[model samples]
Structure formats: C-alpha cells, structure tokens
Target: MKRPERMARLARAQRALAEVAKAESIAANARYEDSARQADEILDALNATNVLHGFAVKAMADTLRRNGRTTERLRRVADERASQYVRQERTAEVLEERATQASSEARRKEERQRIEILVSSPRRR
Candidate 1:
C-alpha cells in the first residue's frame, strides 16, 4: 500500500492499541469490585451459612485473579501489534523517501542529456 495510507493505518492502530489497554484495565477493575462485593457478602452471611459463603468467596477470588492475568496477556498482545505497526510505518516512509529521491535524480539525468545533445548538435547556418 501507499505511504500515506500506511501512515494513516499506523495512527489508527496506535489509537486502537491504547484503547484496548484502557478497556482491559477497566474490565479488570470491574472484576476486582465484584470480588470485593462477594467478600462482603460472605461476611454478611457468616453466621447463617459459613461453609457455603467460604466456598463462594474462594471461587470469586480465583475468578478475579484469572481475569486479571488474562487482561494482562491481552494488553501485551495489543502492545506487540502496536509495535509491529510502527515498524511497518517506518518502512513505508523510508521506501517513499527513496522513491522520491530516485525520481528527482532521473529528472536531472534527463535534463543533462538534453543539454548535452543540444550543445553537440550542428546549428543551422
């Protein structure tokens, strides 16, 4: 694809990566809140159902930990993709610069050849 299009895609990918990290953080926080609520419920039910409350709290805590780890993994993936896109953008820009330089050089060479031909050719009397 063209350099400008690649640049645009790179910007969008960077933005999306930031957004993914933010959203995962929010989700992880929500999981923590839910775990806290479960702990509170367990306390409230301590006298009436100690055994079941303990099990419920344990399960909720485990789930929260797993959710946090999953979010971290997902965030890492997003960061990797962002870096890949950045590399792609740099490559595209480099190629575009080279192409522009090559075109300029070609034009200069053509102009020089034209001048040489004109100078060497015999003029009409």
Candidate 2:
C-alpha cells in the first residue's frame, strides 16, 4: 500500500521480465549456433567428391544458403533480445535502489515522530 512497498513490487516484476528476456536471448543465440552448425555440415556434404546424385548436392547447397540467411536473422533477434534484457535489468536495479531509499526515509520519519512524542511527554515520578 505504501510507496516503497509498491516500488518494491514493481522492481520484482521488472526483474522477472528481465529474466524472461535473458532466457529468450539465450535460446535465440543457441538456435543461431545450431543453424550455423547445420550449414557447416551441409558444406561438408557438398565437399564430398563421391556423391552419386548431383541433385542432392544442389539441394544441399540451396539449403545451406537458406540456413545462412536464417542464421543471420536469428543472430539479429538474439542481439535485440540481449539489449532488451540489459535495459530491463538496469530498470529493475534503479527501481530497487529507489525503493530502498524510500524505505529508509520512511523509517527515519517514524523514528523522528517517536522521538518528538517522547520528548514532549512529561515523565511521572
């Protein structure tokens, strides 16, 4: 209900979002790496001289080209996701810091109020 509490909750949500973004970025990068490995295998297949079927080699070459494009696209997606994750993480950090400051300020205010009350009250002998 308080400002610090609300800010803390928001910071937690942002951290969760950042974690999801980080996972997505890692997955994208893995997919790109796998695609690249497949393209390399296709190249190796094309290099084999004992291939009986010419059409198969042509098909493999075409597939390799397509895979190259896909890999590039995946790389771009991974980079974008990584950047998004960084931004989200930074936002979360800032929110957390602000929440901590607000909480400290609230405590100080309460302490001051308590001190004022104690000082103004008369002690009974």
* C-alpha lDDT values of all predictions: 0.63, 0.90
For model 1, the run of ten residues with the poorest summed lDDT: 42-51
lDDT of 2: 0.90
Q: Per-residue alpha-carbon lDDT of model 2 for 81-121, expressed as tens digits? A: 88998999999999999989989998999999999999999
Instruction: Give the TM-score comparing model 2 with the true structure, all chains together.
Output: 0.94
Query: Model 1, which residues run further than 4 Å from truth?
Result: 1-55
In angstroms, the error of model 2 at 94 is 0.8
Residue-by-residue lDDT tens digits, candidate 1, 5-120: 55556666655665665665566566556655655654455445555666676666666566666656656665665566566556656655666666677678889999999999
What CA RMSD would you report for each candidate? Answer: 8.3, 1.2
User: Clashes per prediction?
Assistant: 0, 0
